[model samples]
Target: MDAFLFQVLAGLATGGIYASLALALVMIYQATHLVNFAQGEMAMFTTYIAWSLINAGMPYWPAFLLTVGFAFVLGVLIERIIIRPVEDAPVLAVVVVFIALLVILNSTAGWIYTYTIKSFPSPFPKEPLFGIRYMSAHEIGAICVTLVVLSLLYAFFRFTPLGLAMRAAAQNAQSSRLVGIRVGWMLALGWGLAAAVGAVAGMMVAPIVYLDPNMMGGILLYAFAAALLGGIDSPMGAVIGGFAVGVLENVLGAFVIGNELKLTVALVLIIGVLLVRPSGIFGKVHVTRV
Candidate 1:
């Protein structure tokens, strides 16, 4: 039972990482109806920025904040310069652009950083909690950060006028334009926000895993599976799905299978979910007007 509890806690910590990235994907999908395949790469680039800052004598907190700000501006700029031009193009175009962006960012990082594995400083203490007997501070901090970010995003989308405009534009671009909303800018903002969120996830996970150009690649797969499991259109679903996937993966890896096949299990679950419920646990069935 203790081992089970420990695995559950461990899963939640890992799931928090997945959930953060999944939330970013959800944000982009909600606004633009297209997944940003470059999300992980963008996050990797921003995390390198944070690493550079820390190496330059900046404290972890300050470096984190600076990286986030840089990530936001970078995201906005990328949207304006690259994505906006192809906004009205076919979905294939957008997908191709994302793939191109991924390659560009990955190559740049490799050239700049030389692909050496580096250790990152943890924002949370490494000590284990007293009395809990098994829970680590790292795990606790991850859970807290995840919940806090999720709450803030929920409030932003629920209460802010800009958020409303973005949602409106996402639902119907033509209708939003008729009402004078800048649909294009809203889409850009969505990408910017998603990028920033992905940056946070990357930074948080970097300390746990070694920092590398491909650090987020595997996590990206887990996140995609979680997002699909939870419902691509539902932010809350993404969070829930991430946790569920995380826990299942951890437990199964510990008991039913080896750690080597954990990702395989996650993929299998994703496929099973798609087959059983195409709309996902929290996804709404879209009714297209013929």
Candidate 2:
């Protein structure tokens, strides 16, 4: 029982990382109707930036904040300069661009960092909690931070005026523009927010895993599974889906099967969900106007 509890706790910590990135995926999908495959690469880049700051003697917290800010601006610029021109193109084009971005960023990072493994300090302490015997303090801290970030995102989308504008743009870009909302700006803002969220995920997971250009690749797969399982278009779905995927994967790996099949489990879940309900749990099916 203790071992089970420990695995559950550990699952939640890892799930938090997946959830953060999944949230970003949901955000972009909601706003622009396209998935940014480069999202993980962007996060990895910003994480490297944070590492550089840390290596230069800056504190972890400050470096993290600075890296997030930098990511936000970088996102905005990419949207304006690279994505805006092709906003009205076919879905394949956008997807291809994201793929291109992924390749470019990954290559750039590898060249810059020499593809070596490095360690990063966790924002939280290393001690375990009072009652938890197997879970570390870092795992607990990850869960707490994930919850806080999720709450903030919920509030931002629910209460803020800009958030409303972004939502409006997502629902109907043409109508939003008719009502004076700059749909382009809203799209850019969405990308910026997604990048920032991805950066947070990268930072949180950095301590648990080695720092490398490909560090987020596996997490990205988990996030993709979580987002798809929960409903790619729904933010809340992503959050719930992330935790579900994490728990399911860990439990299945530990008891039902071996660890080698974890990725397969996630893939199976994603495929099963898509087959059962193409629209996803929380996604609404819409009929296009002819």
Per-model CA lDDT versus the true structure: 0.88, 0.88
Which candidate has the highest TM-score of all?
2
Error of 1 at 208 (Å): 1.2
- Alpha carbon lDDT at 238, candidate 2: 92
Q: How many backbone collisions does model 1 have?
A: 0
Model 2 regions lying over 4 Å from their true place? 288-290
lDDT of 2 by residue, 30-110 (tens): 988888899999999999999999999999888988998999998999899988888889988888998999999999999
Model 1, TM vs. native: 0.95
Q: Which lDDT tens digits does candidate 1 get at residues 2-116?
A: 8999999899898998999999999989887788889899999999999999999999888988898898889889989998889789988888999999999999999999899
lDDT of 2: 0.88
